[model samples]
Target: MSLLKKYCLLGAALWIACAAPAFSEYTALSTLLAETASKLEWNPLLESGVLVKDTTQVVFTVNVPWVIVNGSRRINVDAVRRQHGALVFPESTAKEIRAVLEQTDIPPKVFRVAAIVIDPGHGGKDSGASYVHTINGKSIRVSEKDIVLNLAKKLHVTLKARYPDKVILLTRENDTYIALEDRPYIANTIPVKPDDAIVYISLHANASMSSAAKGFEVWYLTPNYRRDLVTTASVGKEYSEIVTIMNDMKEEEFTRESVLLAGEIASQLESAIGAVTENRKIKEGEWLVVRKAKMPAVLVEVGFVSNLEEATRLMDDAYLQKIEKAIYNGVSHFIEQFEQSKGFTE
Candidate 1:
């Protein structure tokens, strides 16, 4: 039988045996546990007692209308009194206490990565790192915009197939130019609960004046670059100092997650194709994309377009597939770790 039902069956204990003037129905501490099975610990000298059942605990004192519940919530009830060296409370107070134990005091919050945003860098008028090279009398051209878009689409498809329950989105699905500032806006605008988190990953290809610089590099925002992430609407303008501190704390949380994500992707890249070229390793930067994003964010430079050897490899469909696979594995691993760790509190 349920605790509430059993307690209700013991209504005889709440019967008023004799009342001179007051019609109050009180139950004695000794009779409280009679014909019922919930545990009660009472201290007569201290005039205090505690009732415990399942996950609920109720603490009360003699001659007090207020009762401390679960050591946190203080609830008001009819005053408990010491009658003939025994503690007891009126019927109304008993009902109120019973109601408290049946409800409220839910479990702690849990964290989850519910949404992911993939931003393919540069498109349309702003063809990022445009390079024209001729290899063995054959004209070849490589655009960073096109390469990253292909990779982003592949990654999106793979992730969507893997996690159909989660939300996966792209800043620009077609070959359209998206402003740098607008990219992060897509990620920030995603509505999520306080315990829920979002991930923002921007894909790009690197370029240099010298053709020698070639490798895949993952970038995360530097910890030193503080973002102005506080919103005044949540709190009053007079609490600006407190708001700044709170914002700083929130910024640190996203930064930590971004670093973890960057590390995972960098390690996966090395594992994917370490023998072919450089992993370049995860670097710290004040990138606008990462800075503006209000969630965990990272930027990946898949390879260099300026280098003939790297550019030739980048043009290959199979090569881009390898890079895409590496990124997918990295993101998958990070999401697993993040969810399992419950936002990495320890």
Candidate 2:
């Protein structure tokens, strides 16, 4: 079979994400091929792909900002990348190639993560769990609201820098009041196009009556919660009758995604999971991940504040930085894979 024929056959079987509207800065490889009638010969394992258009040829590498034209000329543009493990291209670079092998235009379709919402639990009038400790005769107080807010800000800053195209938000930017319901509401209200996803992460420091409690825990919503996720606005008025079924499907998707996300965060925290607490595990901690948010949401109980030793760790800027790195990296890794597959779990 011809290269084009083979790719066409594999496109459906492989669930290729190489399609995006021309309006987006990034163009999927499939759209580019349709526009230019090009043949793609690329190996995903090698993280590189090539496009053939009559006498013209283009070579692209994942995360590379430049493309090799005809194996001689170097053209710089946005890097060729895997759209959720599927091949895609930057519009700027694809346009140059398109000009060479002009063909009919077709609208491109794509799925991407449009936004991320970070919520810091307990703010303003809510002091949350307050504890005082004396280290070497110096008394210090730990405030749950303050610790989480600071950590949230750090995570927010890092994520915002990494995803300039995404909407990064914090429910409480400062030590201000925000209702529990309002936080997830902020996440759900974020305007997004079809096939676009938004994830919610609520940060909090756990407290227990037993001062010995320590270590970190990540939580996800169980399947029991039924939320009104599908509506005429989401599935269109024509499909409104099946909204209930769609909502169930959405709940399953969100549940699976939440589990995966929580696992990632838990895995990343292993490095710092220490002697203070035994057997750090994933748990159903707070209801923040529950009925409130209409998306894949997780609540991270970042160690137990009730324990003086652990409280000290949460309060420590250096220790908090470690948590920040772990959480940030965890979220980033999940986002990369999620967006790569366009949030397809199965």
Best by lDDT: 1
Work out the TM-score per prediction.
0.69, 0.66
Task: Name model 2 segments beyond 4 Å from true.
Answer: 1-109, 232-237, 274-279
Clashing pairs in 2: 84-340, 84-341
lDDT per residue for candidate 1 within 137-235, as digits (tens), equals 799788999889999999999999998978999998989999999999988888887678899999999999988998999999987677777665554
Q: Per the 3 Å backbone cut-off, how many clashing residue pairs does candidate 2 have? A: 2
Candidate 2, TM-score vs. the true structure? Answer: 0.66
lDDT of each: 0.77, 0.74
Badly placed stretches (over 4 Å) of model 1 are: 1-106, 135-137, 235-241
Clash count per candidate: 0, 2
Query: Model 1 residue 298 lDDT?
Result: 96
lDDT by residue (230-335, candidate 2, tens digit) is: 8768545644433454455467778878888898998888865545455367775338545689988898889877888888777789989988998998898888
| Cα TM-score of candidate 1 | 0.69
Q: What's the residue-level lDDT of 19 in candidate 2? A: 46
